[model samples]
Target: MKAISLLGVGICGGALIAAGCRKTNFVDKMAFKSAINNYYSTRQDCVWPSPVKFPVQADTSNYEQTKGYDALTDTGFLVRKAAEKKRFLIGSKQVNDYDLSDKGRSSWTAEQTQPGYGNFCFGHREVTTIDGFSPADVSDATQYSVSYHYDVAGVPGWASTVEMKTAFPGVAMDMSGQQSAVANVVKSDSGWQVNSVTPTD
Candidate 1:
């Protein structure tokens, strides 16, 4: 409707995939489970930060919440920081925040995101007719885990990259003059606090 320039008010999310297919199997599951268990063995990383405010729907209302941040709120912060430099993604998306639980870990296979775990391959891979920009637009949209890369800072390591489970579907950017993939970086509380979400140009 309006000029969807590189300066709009929206945040974005995406996933990173290893080139080629290296399907994960039984062993990979074991290793991933072991990794999580060992990492959480100290009873850390799984702690849900005290929420500034919680929802009545949440079975437990103790998670950190943001003004527009949704389930993937951890990754939302990075997007927020990136918005300072770009307007195209000023306030594009939101995600629900939850604890990554340092409790007895289970394998990702138990979750079934192999071969394309961090990639935007498995979850909510929808083909719809009209994609609207409201929660109701994708209220019934499928949810899934997608690996996203946030580099609003324009640096590599500074970028926060991780695979996260999210409820919202991907938002398409009407880039009138560019050949950009539906790209974005979401903030999550997997524990890695993101500094920014600079899109790769």
Candidate 2:
């Protein structure tokens, strides 16, 4: 009876040790979502000038482009000047030229790597869902491709204006619903790290 009691106690202790040593799932949708959100939280949504020049010119015929500048002008971020310039195979046409206003220059987010090039930043992005990811052993895989959706957060009143929304499709889509995006995450000592996030059509 003494030997049987000792054997029973040993079996119970072994079972408890096995349960305690169960492997943990470190990589999952929640982990990826957190990593993606962390990546965007430090970034800004910036719209770069298409022409990359001061006094950017836009032909009045292009309603979308002209309206975009008009919206910015209304927001006090741009100054529009009228001009008449010759067009190919046509008479001189009235054009609208734009340059950054004092407020625009103050709010511009200049690119550190490229001098004399900057953008008007509106807001930051936040992850809403982690749609899916590549299947691999969490412990063995060095990288994973994660598909997700996100929305722009903290959008300013100017960006949400009807004119701005109509002019910039990106702003409209970002504000209307979640936008699809893909991110590459790599394993590191600190856990999953998002390397890059790119918007998907």
Candidate 3:
């Protein structure tokens, strides 16, 4: 009778373990999807062109005024500005939602604005479709993998000569492409965050 009782306990223990795994996986999947969606949404916003504003008088001496005018005509400047805003959404070692000190922002801004850094600029990004999430092979609950398919258009900057000749005139270049990728999501103490995005083969 004791042997039979031991066997029953073993079976119950195995079932409990399976149940726990299923529950953890379910939660992780949900958290991973949420993080991906948030990241995508912010990326879309980042490419949106800010309203065009040109200074009444060019002020090269004033950095702020000069930067504003440059954004109107220089695609690189706009790209860097948008990148700065996006950094706020995706917290980095230096910049996070909790502590967005001016110092942190300034660091990223300077990086983006570095000379010859911007080769391409995007006017807007529209996500045509997003595929369902897929599980990734990882050992821990804190890390999750997901796959997605998306179509995006990188509108060339206002400065593109090709864009200037558009039928509408002064319109940006339309550069569209499709992408499929796998992304890793990490669960931090604060919440789920996207660790990195990699293109899938």
| Each prediction's TM-score versus the true structure | 0.13, 0.75, 0.36
Any runs in candidate 1 off by more than 4 Å, and if so which? 1-27, 45-201
lDDT preference between candidates 1 and 2, better one: 2
Candidate 3 Cα RMSD after full superposition onto the native fold (Å): 16.5
lDDT top scorer: 2
- What candidate 2 gets wrong by more than 4 Å, as runs, is 1-28, 48-51, 86-91, 136-141
**Pairs clashing within candidate 3:** none
**Per-prediction RMSD in angstroms?**
26.9, 4.3, 16.5
* lDDT by residue (tens digit), candidate 1, 12-131: 211213343334422122322232233223321111222222221221232333322333334432222212122285743333333222221221112143332211111111111111
Candidate 3 lDDT over 1-201, as tens digits, reads: 999999999999899987774533334455555676667665532222332221134334445444433443333232221111223667532211121223323322222444422222234333344454544343366666667654444443343444233322223222324556677777788788888888663
Residue-pair clashes, model 2: 0
Candidate with the greatest TM-score versus the true structure: 2
Q: How many residue pairs clash in each candidate?
A: 29, 0, 0
